[model samples]
Target chain A: MTIVSTADLLAILPELLVMAGGCLVLVLDPLTAKDRKDWLAYFSLAVLGAAFVVGYWFMGALTGSPRPAFSGLYVLDAYGAFWKLLLILVSGLVILLAKAHLKLEEIDLPEFYAFILLSLSGMMVMVSGTDLLVIYLGLELMSLSLYVMAGFKRYAPRSLEAAAKYFILGSFSSGILLYGISLLFGRTGSTTLAGIRDGIAGLPPGDPILLMAMGLLVVGFGFKVAAVPFHMWTPDVYEGSPTSVTAYMAVASKAASFAAFLRVFLEALGGIKESWRMLLVAVCIATMVLGNVVAIVQTNIKRMLAYSSIAHAGYALIGLVVADAAGTASVMLYLAIYAFMNLGAFAVVTMLRRGGLEGDEIDDFTGLARRNKWAALVMLLFMFSLAGIPPTAGFIAKFYIFMAAVGANMTGLAVIAVVFAAISAYFYLRVVMVMYMKEPGETAGTPGYDVRVVASPAAIAVLLVAALGVLILGVFPDPLIQAAQSAILPLK
Target chain B: MVPIFFAYFALVSIVAGLLTVSLRNPVHCGIALLALLGHVAGLFVLLHAEFVAVVQIIIYAGAILILYLFVLMLLNLKTEERYFHRRHAWYITGVGALTVELLMVLLASRFSGAKGPATVAAVEEIGNSTAIGILMFSDYLLPFEIVGVFLLGAIVGAIVLAKTPSPADLSGDER
Candidate 1:
């Protein structure tokens, strides 16, 4: 047996702390007094907040940090560190947003915080899974928690139905993924990507087993990314989950999964590029075009956002299909920008909501401009960003992605993505028009609109999200874009 | 070492797996899933992976499957006394059977390729733990951590959604 080193744990310290934090919270929640259980919220936030700092430290440790700590089970690399930090940031922001979202809905469980922490920990591990088994475990950890969260509003049958449907589809996809893993493990005799690469290298080109692995694994990942044909569960699940949790799923979970997807395909199966490039290209085009076109018709704002997310996934995937250094950077830039735009938009929706039940339909947003001009403006910014409109981060993100695709001689796919982006703009702009042009109305209320205009928790979260959308990296995209290039696999 | 053992385990796995899906009573299915889990553990042990075998029992059988049972009970799945569904259930089972069989066949063909490296390359490592541990720490260290955050998000979400609103908050009497 090899001796485990301290540096190895340091590489995984953030993950450990979060994992321990989750278990600790789980253990402590039952003992805490009823109202004080909310303190677990702060405890969770503090843990993730601290781990975010640790993730930054890991960024420093990733460079030239190839020392095998657990022999070879885990590796410290810029690739993994990048996702770690992104997920940590997303988790913290989501926690803050959930404070009001959940409170407004009057739903609470100390168990909720612990589960989210565990899932995010899973996502971080997924980003750096040099081994297939590790990836499966990470995927499951994330999937299980997500399944529970999707239906946490158990009293609401829609949430329950969404949870059930997601579980059935997700478990089926997982079976396919596991089958692929087992096949890959059999072919390589080793589950590690390095070992698998060596195995594939020894085999003849276009081996049947390798093809099968690709088919199954692609189907598996396709589901997670909401790619075409495999995207049936996404719209339902995303719409059913609470707006805040949906925001987490749309941005952070998607980003981390794609990060892992990019690495596994690039590093482990680069040899089989020719076979998959076209396959993924087809999936990308289908996802983008279908996602956008269908989203145009959704009346429910959450469902509309869900379809739009699928479309954005297609755009981000164009970056991966290009398979170049610039492509990785494009994906990263898009994800960071996407985080703000999508989450901000959801935050606005959450803010507009009143009473216990969420305000979900598009009609709810009518006269939003009159009700709250700042929120309307913020929503406009998010919509513009989402639509790839000029002067917003979305436009810059698309420019880079298309540029990367063109660089890879994938001009056709890039052009298609651009056209879809234009189509998406219509729906996004439609929301703005409704908000600005429509009239506000109310029958009567206890906290009447005439007197009760106090800012709620949801409003506070929207402010943060809107600020992130308008300012964070939109005005200063270079730094975030540059980081994407360094954090991902260099395609030289 | 006995062929009968392999045959018996395979039969048990197939039967239990079927019962897990076919049984209308979720409690019955849950117990059947335990049987399937036991068979899977035996299969793992047969493959000489003690660690995986142990985990199959403890994690899969002891924890996850048990969670399913508890949830089923909590939901009072037996409320109707007789579970009923559409006749189309056969269609679903048929597809599942075809897929699982296809997988088994596919796996059969793959045994030879991975045999050499797995046997010799892994002999130096004790109980497959060291090899598994090394791959996890050195290669998968990154994904290992993010999963924690995923769980955290889930817990927080569940808690916030499931928490009961105090009357003050419900009545709009408190901020």
Candidate 2:
């Protein structure tokens, strides 16, 4: 008998395409000349575009029921499709952003493109995984690529330090996650979500072993998503890595981790919602409080964005705590909007490099409006969206999340989140203030005086797409809302 | 005979594990780890998981331990006079107490999970290696394939980080 049928292969066509594309890039990296390396970035983008098209096509072909493949180790459904599409889009934008940034930083290597494709494939696998083991493997694949990419700048000591710290802490968390999976396997006799649910249904409420496993799982996922208490690595890693990588890690990795986190909890542990609900509520509150309060003190733009990303994770966790269809759909919408705005913000940061100077500090934005009106304008849009201001996608994202929380009778949590959201706006708006209000300082023999906003054609293209996405989504969110609503139908 | 073998393997492995961590000399630590791995493999063999036992010896004891030794030697790391500080007594005590508490809790609880289909009789009938091969090829195929991509990523990442750039590349105006 055949082990993998044709249907199974067809089911994973997008993943296959990405893996093939990654391998092709690796093979072609050394064969191609040095100056033509930019082609590799474009090639990787084409591959991501192809995978997105394929995934979207399959999404259209999705039936009412989720289709299981590989003995139910993986599944193809609208939820997975939605996440895959978002991840692909984020990865593509990151590549465009990276093309110029890498050249500017002098760390342009074709392997960078290969790692992106490989990691994107890992995230695709992660979102579609139906089994805990499959999810763990996918998580590892994604993280391993990121760990390497984090230290891509070998010449920079901070970059190396970031990679080492991320690698050590990330591996420790993965070990904890694997230990939890093993404990869960021992308790339930199965690693698949359906089997785990069935097994859990037969167990007594609050079984100590199962509770321990659940808590461990939460800790593991908390680290990956950069939730508070597990967010120590976020600032250092984000500030130290290449800006393009920071953007990708901040958006795509968090999105994929949340997708897997929701699936594992809602599908496998949905039987014991009361037990995990309070646990996540506490975590959510702590994450928001710490992420926002600490972000106010950050001077570096990357570090501030890192804390903002942490706060965003907390906001998303509110949906997980609600544990309903509306909660899930709100999270999907929030992350999609977050992707556009966050990537736009990082894309601007990526282009802020002048000769021999890294313009990553908030002071770099002093009189940015005077220097480049368009850059400042796009940055303002992103900051406004990030702060959840009106007529911005960020506002809509937060509104949905709070609405979902309130609908589930979680008014207390919603109120707490709104307070934190209001607190977060101060820092996001601070960027705009620095740009439009402050005068550019002229220093003797420092590149600070001539802080030129260097925008390559590729970077400009990214800015346009991201800005358009933020504006369009902010104004007309009906289509995405409907899509997110339909996407969560499988979970119910 | 079986109980005697099990006791010997389990006891030795636990002692070796402690030694691996406590030994000051790096080489001695490596040796202790090797002994720990060998004893764990012995325990696995006693459980009739011969395939896993062999793999444990080959992969962990043979490959990984050797790589550790190579790195240790290449780095020429000097053994420090003091590995732990006396001022950290309270910290150590807290950790030890927590570990003891965890052990007590684990020893008190009974494992009440349902058993799987892969009983001893089933494994013996199918043969351990063949059973594992079947599972890897069929039910675990997707994970198996994903591992390939994972390793490729790791290999490429290692190369990208470790590869020394030539002078011409480093002298570019981009830097």
Candidate 3:
């Protein structure tokens, strides 16, 4: 029997900080009057900032070595550190965005920030966990917080609908994931990834129970990352939820899920790659095609971004299919790049609202360049990056993934992904065109009345940060590439 | 003797599961779900997992089922004119496909085989709860703590979703 020591607690410092901070915010929320909720946002931001500091410090302390603490139920490594930093950064940015949006919408509830911080805590735990049970608990914690956050605007019927839809589907997918874990446990009599790996090391390929477990796990993960056939909830949830919450879900949740998915597959089930590779290939193809094709028809900006997000998930899967060190590194880099571009796009969407009208429709963005050139240009940069256009981070992300795929001799899948990516250009470019080329629609109260588009300074700051991150990543991606490479060194 | 009890519990659980789904009135369905949970607990007892059986009874049959009944009563749901909608055909088809897939996998696996990685030989000797407690405190400590955070999140989520908006909120006054 291995004894757990103080090292276990030290290894999980980031998660502990976030959880404690979240509880602090939750407790402080009710004590303060509902009107002065910005303090809560500031408090949550400070907490996330502390978590980031601790994460970086711990990452530096760990240096190059991977340590499995608490008897290998949790791991402290560059991989977890890399994603934790990203999650912490994303959560902080989302809080800033939420602060501005919630102020605008008159939502004074402090629980919003608390939920987001708790969800971030959950994601941190997930990316760091080595055991299936720990991962599942973290996932549930994240999902539950998100379900509430999605319906943060309880007065809005659409928000309520989004919450209900997300809750039911999310619970079902979690059930499927748990069932898969149970099946694997039954086969291996162990729930830790390392144990499962050791148990299945000598097994022949294509064991039916193993195959079923893999399929179920894939289905479960497919739902989490918004892959095809399992992505039916994405658009509705994205469209109906508050824009700030939508951005948080799109960026942070996907990163955490993919992080966990990579750890489980590339580490636990890497030996059974032959049995699962074909299923993933099919999923990748279908996700790219369906997500791209369906995105073109969306007039709602949030729904379009949701579909594009799904397509991006497929693009990320290409690297995982390659199943090499470079592939894992590229996927990490892609997610890092994606978190910026996707959140930036949603930030712009959140900015579009003013004077009690939602700017969700594509038509609302018509002639945005004429109204607000800076917003349009920022939106343009985000759209270009999302479409994987050259001189943008998205292009570099795609290039690395495709390069990894080609190196693995999966040229056919790479080509298919590229073709779908080109197809996606149509919809992403359509947003740019509407913002730049088309004329602004007439204001509602009067003919030819100009509506003032207002964005708080905080939201603009988020957009700027995201846009700058994209351009910097596009031009000088070597540092991030190196970071990503080291992050997945364990996979090699 | 165990096989006879197992068969009885399994059959009853299956029938109760079907009834839980088929019954039009939600209260009756809730009762069916209770029966199903009880039979599942019985099956757990037959497996010699006394701890699990007790948990199944206390958590599922006692608390969760009662909560379901309270929710059904609170919602004041009426009897539906039609049990299944036209669009529900896809639901049926989907469930059918899943069942078939599961059945094929189970058959192909040939379930009677050497048990893999029997890691818990001492479980019975130490007793189920005690062994679990030991593992929970040691190897499973991280997950156990994570479960605490998850429950905390759930509690916060429940309050956020269910609480009536305060008067300050209804007034829409900016801070």
Candidate maximizing lDDT: 2
Which of the numbered candidates is closest to the native, going by highest DockQ? 2
lDDT of 2: 0.91
Expressed as tens digits, the lDDT of each residue in B5-30 for candidate 2 is 99999999988998897787889999
User: What digit string (tens of lDDT, one per residue) describes model 3 on residues A376-407?
Assistant: 99999999999999899999999999999999
Instruction: Provide the TM-score, chain A, model 1.
Output: 0.95
Score every model by TM-score. Answer: 0.84, 0.96, 0.95
**What is the C-alpha DockQ of each candidate?**
0.24, 0.56, 0.52
Clashes of each: 71, 0, 0
Residue-by-residue lDDT tens digits, candidate 1, A1-492: 344567767767887888888889988988999878768878998999889888787787666444444556666787788778878877877777777777765556667787778888788778876777777778888887878878766666677778888889999999999998888877777877777878888877777788789878889999998889899988889888877778888888898889878877887777788888888999999999899999999988999999999999999999888887788878888887888788888887776654434667676777778877877888888898889887888888888999999998988888898899999988999898887887765654422123112256645765566566556566678777767777777442
**What are the candidates' interface root-mean-square deviations?**
6.3, 2.7, 3.8
Better of 2 and 3 by DockQ: 2
Pairs with steric clashes in candidate 3: none
Residue B3 in candidate 3, Cα distance off native in Å = 3.2
Q: Could you tell me which 10 consecutive residues in candidate 2 chain A have the lowest summed lDDT?
A: A441-450
Largest TM-score belongs to which candidate?
A: 2
- All models, RMSD in angstroms: 4.8, 1.9, 2.4
Candidate 1: list runs displaced more than 4 Å.
Answer: A24-40, A61-68, A354-356, A442-454, A457-462, A490-492, B1-111, B116-175
